[model samples]
Target: MITQRQILGTGAAVLAATLTVAGCSDSGEQSGGDAGGSASIVVSTFPFGVEEFTQAVLDPFTEATGIEVEIDTGSNADRLSQLSLADGSNGVDVMLISDTYAGMGEEEGLFQPVTAADVPTMDEIAPFAVSEQYSGPAYSYQLNGTMYNTDELTAEEAASWDLYANADYAGRLALPDISVTAGQLMVSGVAASVGSGPYDVDAAFATLGEWAPNILQFYSSTTEMTNLLTQGEIVAGDALNGFATELVAAGEPIAWTAPAQGRYMATNRAMIPVGAENVEGATKFIDFLLGVEAQQASAEIVGDLPVNLGIEFPQEIIDVVGDIAQDPTGAGYETLDPREIVPNRDVWVERFAREVVGG
Candidate 1:
């Protein structure tokens, strides 16, 4: 597990969120810049994140053009703080943040215009991969879901998150770290299940208060959760697919699902600071990310759905790892859309921290 202390690097402070414009006008047809000679760019990403993303997406850029790149990896909090500080400063070239983390950055203007049109593969990526109005989703995943140990529980019992909270299974379940997006969603599902809407704080905390004891620990890191699963510490509730995929791919018996009761579909995005200095480079990287080869490579390495429309993968890539099966009675788990709930993010987070985290 990557700790925030070891991950956050010293950063240069740029513009805080206090910049105000005399007259707010359109960014005036996305700013454009041509590639001059060769240059390097800095990309900040999540800690213990996918280096394979860089290898799959960045390496080819370097190979094609002699430009070099460097990365600063940290926890979700570290990246958010750094991105907030870099809001108007071009000190950081490009930043990749998860869908859960993207909201704050998107609201704070931490991103620049993406030259999506320049990327030939733009049409091939999934529709949700594109940002709503400002930045676009780099790549995304339905990361929030349940993967139960087959030896301990049968497929019938591992179908949804609610099972862990059932009276029969009480005191034997465990949940993922509260700090991440998927974990929050798994916990949030409990709230939304009994509420009027996705953001109902009243419903979320009530559910957590009830489910809390059944959970052994709110793991702070994926590695810890992995160890817990391996050692039989916690049977299951929810987790990110990477850990689950590895086990399932290895033939460890497991059952998985993304409950329709509002499972999270996490997206990584490319944002340009509102007042960035190297806008040209940032946009270029964004386009590079959306290109065909980049999409193919990124999806292959990271094991998530590719957002870029252009990359056509061989059947091997598409069929390599199949998706999780959804439960028919588990809150319409197949078609949950996360964007609709963005407006309630802060409220949801607070509600989870209070009721679910037992704060």
Candidate 2:
């Protein structure tokens, strides 16, 4: 129920507290020497955009706090698996991963709890960013929606789930494969639309199975979906909103629209491993990442929707999502509970392949 105005208004005091703890100062001297003074941490993050991320977040943090940051990058699943296999000796101090993977790590005891006491900035982010189900907090989020060829469909048509099943668009539409993030969101959206709620698999599969014949491809990667859309091979697909940002900006005849019903979002979290070598450094890094300046830089460079409510988004971000970023929950977007998702993930993926895509 928090409005954008309220969130923005509350940020001034929060940012002041965050700056004190983060060791940032106008004199370019490390104010909080405990986390500075030659402390170091290894940060595991998504492989893409390393340069941009380092410039926007890591470099600034090191400059402000004198914490040495070593970069480690991989896919979410790969990094999580490594952490599990290492049994707390992964040497990873902090991990920036998706919420789903963070939940899995929490269940496996690979990560330790990160409370607001450890990261004061946690109190400033949107409520959803503070996880009740994981060991970390969400730093940024992605919304699931429809990305379509603007020349082929009206915005109204793209905003409805029915577009996937329309006979007129058969053989020219793509849907994310169940193995991917968008695929799971699409399933839940269908479930909510046709059955009792987001977890109603029976209703979701039944509806998706019927629509299968109309879909040209079950895409598993961003490249596949973007290529299909760019070449005019597919008219539309269910995808995360970020997928359409670049294409739309380049003057491609493409657009993204949030579905009229059953909207869902996914988050990227900042988690500390169970045996992190430098917990204090990790905590400081997380606090800095959640601060207003870092959040705004990330939104502009990484194309992520900032969880820091105080951030005034860049024009590029606004053009892609409009005011939805201001208050996702108010706009009807929901994030799936990882507790429910973790236990049933394998079964859901198997069934989706067999009953939905296999049909």
Candidate 3:
């Protein structure tokens, strides 16, 4: 098993420095020189886990296809803002972004539509991963679930959404704030459990409001929630499955479970921006990312849950998610529609603060 320190410390700083320097190149220009007459494409990606991602996906891709890759990394909002400001001249050939931001970009016409004709691997990934809602396909996904201290709770006890409101655990549980990714999932989960469906914010907020006093905190960051769990300040919290995996691997007595009633997931997609200089190379890179080998490596190294149906997850992942990694949809996980999310995001955030967290 990979230790937390090893996963967090390895080559990340150097990779960040390299990306910072590379990202300074002018808009509409490829940051790296062409390699052996092969196309050079700039890939905009998340800032964290740079080293693992490069090793798992980028370097091997360059080795195989001779397509030089230049990386640009930042938070989703910041990077998407940059791409928008650049108009069609962002010079980013491929964008690895969360589904929400991808949907926003698609609505703004910042990305070009991609199909199986452009990336054959699209046919092999999960159907939800290639939804017509976005121009690109999901390369990876995340499940929202409850994380609990095994010493304090059983898997059966933690699997219910009612755990948050249980008087026995009052003032010893946490829930994500409505601003983060996990927050949205929790809201949708609660909505699905107590109301009509995932988008039933009225039912979700009312239920959460009633349970607010029981919650130790409405945590805004993963670090805060994880620290609370580790210090035994809180026994359990609603969090992304990734947050619990490392802690569980480190023998922290942490365990995560998909809630018995409502389950939702978020995805990260591989998108091609409009005016991408190397469209063919972009398609090729995305194809490689969705391929079985690349998906497996990403799951093992970068800890992303693969979207490719053919991927046989590594033992480390199995140790964490068990059989859910095999078939997420069959296991009762569903992705929330981005169209339902993007437009109402602000209103929901405000209401969540006023009614659920604050009330």
Candidate 4:
């Protein structure tokens, strides 16, 4: 379900999951070294095909810096294990992981600390997107909102987040379980609508309890939520921009919209291993990614929001995400600091189970 606990890079469950990340062989030799002595570095990103990411971010980076690049793809758990094993010389150079894992890795001295001086293009990122806990700023994000089956409800009825609580939606709604990122965003957005921020755990809980009756199911993933919508088993619920775009591409009659209170945002960041053999090259790659060209290209390929400032999205994207820029930290949207949610997440998840799900 990708909880903050998992994202924070902790828990016995995390240990168990990472222990399963066993495929990559440990290499003593430097990766991707060319005849000119320019050394290559290995990078791990979300579970993407080597060809897809190679075209999106890696190829442009290598072309610009003359540094060779090797790519690894896996879940957050696997990436954390790879980072732990790579420290001090085994050779994975950089990784794109959730903010929680990055912070935990920095604390354990597994990753190098980054600053604007190290990647001057950090100036192009929103202040909030720049990590206080890791070397790389946020490279991309998922802006979340209500996704509804267009044939089932008018756009006006789905214009506010309060629809999750309306009894009128009984047997027709779906939502993320409290343990996941989308669930946390739903809780925070509801809390904000009631004038309570995420810190007021009681307020968020109360809001969920009120909405519990109408929630057809508390989903564990976007796939489950979208599948229900596709089959007409559910009408609407919380979903991310990227995945919803996939639903539309697959021919489902679905649409995503930011409600009156605003949408919730979460970002995934990139980090360099603490003792990278090619620190200069790694930093250059990070800077190149933060630049508009890479950022825009990524948005086009992945459908996730870019973190680079001043990158205007296409009219089609702007239509789906009205009032909110593709960037979460951009003007007019409400953003949640994973830091604020991490400390209280376990308690909130427990409470949500007992109170709303009747666990």
Candidate 5:
């Protein structure tokens, strides 16, 4: 089909055609774009942590059909804006975004609500990603509780997310910036050490206070943390499991602990955008992504677990990618509640901005 520059000015025309073809609720069912008689479909998504998989899974799609595939990837937030701006009324045919981001969009009435019927792999996702309103458990990951230099950690230290700090360990630690669920849980680990424990905000802040004088800089972004770990700029702190894996995989001196404390998990997804007409193609693509083979390929390429249990990866990926890991207490997504940890996301977001990040 058409290239980026060709479609750039056609967003409005595409959206208008979609509106003419179908009707959708703001938070209701969405349609795909005009697959038309064209030889290919253009797909969009936010850039993944690793860029290798951008087109890895698409060739099969092309071979199966004569449809050539075009990929546009960017930050999750930015991708949302682009899709919203393009709509189905615009030329953006399909979108692949994180579930958490989808939840936000779902709230904005951007995506159509969906069920397992829409995408079969919906059943494969861990409960952490599912919600009553939106569709899917597309990609799943756990925010693993890890220690740097696993070689330097003791059996006791390896066992829990409790006070990982010691007088000497102070000032050398790098903690996750408290912005999302992972950051909230990182604070929870410190709470457990200070008697506040997991899901207790009061305790988390107290723990931070204790370490404030000694703790290294509280990271504000994912990239900063990754770079710091890579250059050995900092040794250890509460880190995202994926980043921890990247560091270790790259042979960074850091080692990660699969802590017994409950880890935070995020399941990402994609949904049909409102005010678009590609419903036929968009729905098919969503269904295709949830299939066993596609899920498996996605997990292997991205280093995140497939929500589908049957999708198996090589041993190397399963070992690194975060799946469902129960806490030492054994109460996780199955038995425990998400609200107990985050409660009101708005409140958490606000608190994180002020107290945690000092923003």
Candidate 6:
């Protein structure tokens, strides 16, 4: 029953500051420079509009490693801008980036290269967690799928992405706009289901055209979509796993299922900026995050599927989201390679507006 306003911190602007284990200080040293010399690392994360993530993962890492963790959080665009401005001299020690930025970050030399040897917990993770599309490894995962009110749409009708394009569901649906990853995923999911790859841009555009009439509104955030769902405004449509989990837990009548064609899977990778002062400490912390304890906490607290295979999720999570812990590819979930999608992001956005929204 945790509300979005409760999980997502108050919208007050959080200044980026390096907090030491002892207390908060504003010296702004990239690395820990306190007289005590206790190691500290600066980490920048994309605020998923949630506060529980900090308590579930970041705080525990600091307590266990005795490394002061400096936190900076913002929207995806804001975080990337802050990272691009940093040159490692005053850069973040760890950066949690989405697949959209992973390739660009590597091309810009924003992160240090890591391997299984560098991170012992690497082998315990799913093969996809190593991230073929990005230089950094994935720490958490999500799947894009159709979620709907079971009272209205039977599970059979909601069982596939095809439901979005169904003429019967027109004017009662909600969809993600191009700004969010879920919107991009909607493109890929449609393309694959209709027999097209990332290269076939027209195929995706055409599919969305068919779906446009059914979409009542295009949502820019999970909070907006959840509001629509709670108000009985949106009966069925595509959405991310975590958002759906929140709605279900809050006693909403909504339910989710990956389509038969497959869900579009994504991951958030954590990278150490090239100029990180505490490479060893940062690596250990990354390794710790991939361990069972942190992974379990994330799953239980935020419904973020852990990349680690060793950890078991609670039955409640399983009931709401079946087989989410499995390798997305192995489970027949089609993943849009970030490498392929990143280059064409702008074009896709433009087409989404012109073809889907404006059509």
Model 4 spans with C-alpha error above 4 angstroms: 1-28, 31-38, 81-90, 106-109, 249-251, 310-312, 326-331
| Model 6 pairs whose backbones collide | 170-214
Q: Rank order by TM-score, top first? A: 3, 2, 6, 4, 1, 5
By lDDT, rank the candidates, best first.
3, 2, 6, 4, 1, 5
lDDT of each: 0.57, 0.82, 0.84, 0.69, 0.54, 0.72
Estimated TM-score per prediction? Answer: 0.77, 0.89, 0.91, 0.82, 0.74, 0.88
Stretches of candidate 6 above 4 Å error?
Answer: 1-27, 30-38, 48-50
lDDT of 4 by residue, 1-359 (tens): 00111112334443344323322332225443332243566666665433455677778887877666665555666667656765634455667887756655665678777678988888988776875645668887777678998998877788687788788779789988877677777777777777556456577677777777888899987788988888899889887776777666666788887666745777788787866667776778788888988888776765657778767775556656755764444544655665676566677889989987883
Which has the higher TM-score value, candidate number 2 or candidate number 6? Answer: 2
Worst 10 residues of 3 by lDDT: 1-10
Model 3 lDDT per residue over 84-104, tens place: 888845667788899888878
Candidate that scores best on lDDT: 3
What lDDT does candidate 2 reach at residue 305? 92
Candidate 5 steric clashes: 22
The TM-score that candidate 6 achieves is 0.88
Off by over 4 Å in 2: 1-38
The best candidate in terms of TM-score: 3
lDDT of 5 by residue, 88-116 (tens): 33445566665445666655566666577
For model 5 the local lDDT of residue 69 reads: 49
lDDT of 1 by residue, 148-235 (tens): 6678876556656567677776666767654566666665566567787555657767776777878777776666766677677666
1-359, model 2: which lDDT tens digit per residue? 00001011222443233211221122123212233343667787876776678888988898898776766566777778878888855667789999888888988988888999989999999999986788899999999999999899988999899998899999999999877888888888989998999999999999999999999999988789889999999999899999888888888999999999889999999998987767888899999999998999998888889999899988777777788999999999999998888999999999989998887
- In candidate 3, stretches whose alpha carbon ends up further than 4 angstroms from where it belongs are 1-19, 23-38
